[model samples]
Target: MTLTERLNQDMKTAMKEKDKLTLSVLRMVRSALKNKEIELKRPLDEEEALGVVSKELKQRKDSLHEFEQAGREDLAQKTRDEIAVLKQYLPEQLTEEELRQIVRETVAETGASSKADMGKVMKAIMPKVKGRADGKRVNRMVQEELQ
Candidate 1:
């Protein structure tokens, strides 16, 4: 099934099971998906849905950090729960070694010789690693390789 269909089914199950945390997180995801569809005037494909999920997860992580900084453990915990639920939709993440290999390949493919070519390398690599690796981690790897 498509990601949207699967999410809808899970929403129903969550509602039936009275899983408030899961249901709330799922609803937020649904809203984000719906908003994107409305904005783009089309249904999202799996890749697009994955992108949305990644964006939401990043937002949750940032919010969790802010909450913690503000000494709001309860809110941070809620964001953590949401992040856990959202992560279920993402593909398996890349390992550090695998990420380094891909980064090396991308640098070679793009002929990126120095830190000055970081953008070129990143542009060539991000799409290949999308949803599979974190951007900051990839950036660090690229920098380390170039330097």
Candidate 2:
């Protein structure tokens, strides 16, 4: 099934199982998807849906970190639960070695000899690594490789 369909199915399952956390997360996903559709004036393909999921997951992670640092463990835990539910829709993440390999290839392809060419390398690599690797981790790897 497509990611959207799968999400809808899981939403129903969550409702049936009385999984409030999962249900809330799924509702958030549905709202994001619907909002995107309304904004773009079209439906999303699987990749587009996955992109939405990735964006939501990233937001949750950032919020979770802030909440933890602010000593709001309860809110942080809720964000963690949301992240767990959202992650089910993403493909398996790239390993560090795999991401490093892609970064090396992208650097070479873009002729990125120095830090100044970071943007070129990143533009080339983002499409290949989208939804698979974390941007911060990829940026650090590229910096380490270039320097």
Candidate 3:
């Protein structure tokens, strides 16, 4: 199923199951998807929709870190729950070794021999990894591989 259909299906299930957390997250994501469609004035293809989901997940992770840093356990837990719900929509994440291997290949492909060429490596690699890997983790891997 397309991401939108999957979201709608799960949202209904959440309502029936009385899963407030999952329901709330799905509603938020659905709204975001709608806004994106309106903004673009066209329906999103699967890749674009996945980008929206990944953006939402990234935002939740950032909020989660802030909540933890501020000692707001309640908010942190809620964000963690939201993250779990969002993760259901993302592609499976890359393993550390797999990510490292990909980073090495990207660096080689781009001929990024030093930190100065980091941008080249990242530019070439980000699209390859997309939702499968976190940007921070990719950056670290690229940095490690370049050294």
Count of backbone clashes, every candidate in sequence: 0, 0, 0
Q: For residues 1-147, write the lDDT of model 1, one tens digit per residue.
A: 989998999999999999999999899999999999999999888999999999999899889989999999999988888989999999999999999999999999999999999999999999998999989999999999999
Q: Which segments of model 1 are wrong by more than 4 Å?
A: none
Q: How well does candidate 3 score on lDDT at residue 66? A: 100
Per-candidate TM-scores read 0.97, 0.98, 0.97
Q: Compared with the true structure, what per-residue lDDT tens digits does model 2 show for residues 10-128? A: 99999999999999999999999999999999999888888999999999999999999999999998898899988889999999989999999889888899999988888889889
lDDT of 3 by residue, 15-108 (tens): 9999999999999999999999999999999989999999999999999999999999999999999999899999999999999999988888
Q: Runs in model 2 with CA error above 4 Å?
A: none
Single out the weakest 10-residue window by summed lDDT for candidate 3: 104-113
lDDT for 128 (candidate 2): 93
Q: What TM-score does model 3 achieve against the real structure?
A: 0.97
- Provide C-alpha RMSD values for all models, in order: 0.8, 0.7, 0.9
